[model samples]
Target: SFCPDSDLIRPHRPVNPAAASRSHQELHKELQRLSQEGKTELQRALEKRKWEQRMKASRDQEEAKKSTSPLHQELLKRHQRLENVLSSHCYCCFQFLKLRQIKQRQLLSIDI
Candidate 1:
């Protein structure tokens, strides 16, 4: 006959089987809830990244259109031509003013 006191190295067991089962169920439910929350968060992050990529692509397309449009190119060329014409006109005016000043100085010296 084995005495219970003699089994000093016996494995521990739950005193109430129903309570242990309930605790296990609660732990499983909590694990499932956390897994579902993590999955939802991951899905939302992926969606946000996709939306941002689409927006960036749209912006890039618009920029390309603006740069390559025929009207925009023509306007840029006209603006450059106008700038060149104005610069040359200003240079001519400056040269005429300098020549007038030199002639006035020469006449004043002759009269003296």
Candidate 2:
């Protein structure tokens, strides 16, 4: 029977060049995979930075819009006030013309 304590045997070296070539090929494939993974991570980081910049720009535009909202309302209010004043002035002009006509008619009746 084989010895029960023989589990510590050293591994045998390959005798053919084919086995060495296979190991080299495997190592090359692993290096290429790691390089590709690193490139992908760098690409992801770049995209994330672009996304952050776009979000910041959007926030700034929203703030600018909000700041101008009150100014727009104030301009509308001023326009309405000007419209009211013009309407009142037009009405006053009409009343003045009517009074002038009536006064002229009264003078004609007295002279006749």
Model 1 spans with C-alpha error above 4 angstroms: 1-62, 65-67
lDDT of each: 0.86, 0.85
Single out the weakest 10-residue window by summed lDDT for candidate 1: 11-20
Tell me the RMSD of model 2 versus the true structure: 15.6
25-110 per-residue lDDT for model 2 (tens digits):
79778767867776654677798999999999999999887777777989989999999999999999999999999999999999
Candidate 2 similarity to native, TM-score:
0.40
Count clashes in each candidate, considering only residues at least 3 apart in sequence or on different chains.
Answer: 0, 0
Model 2, stretches more than 4 Å misplaced?
Answer: 1-68
For candidate 1, the TM-score is 0.47
Tens-digit lDDT track of model 1 for 1-112:
6578795776687487654698887877876786877665467779999999999999999999767878878998999999999999999999999999999999999999
Query: What is the Cα-based lDDT of residue 92 in candidate 2?
Result: 100
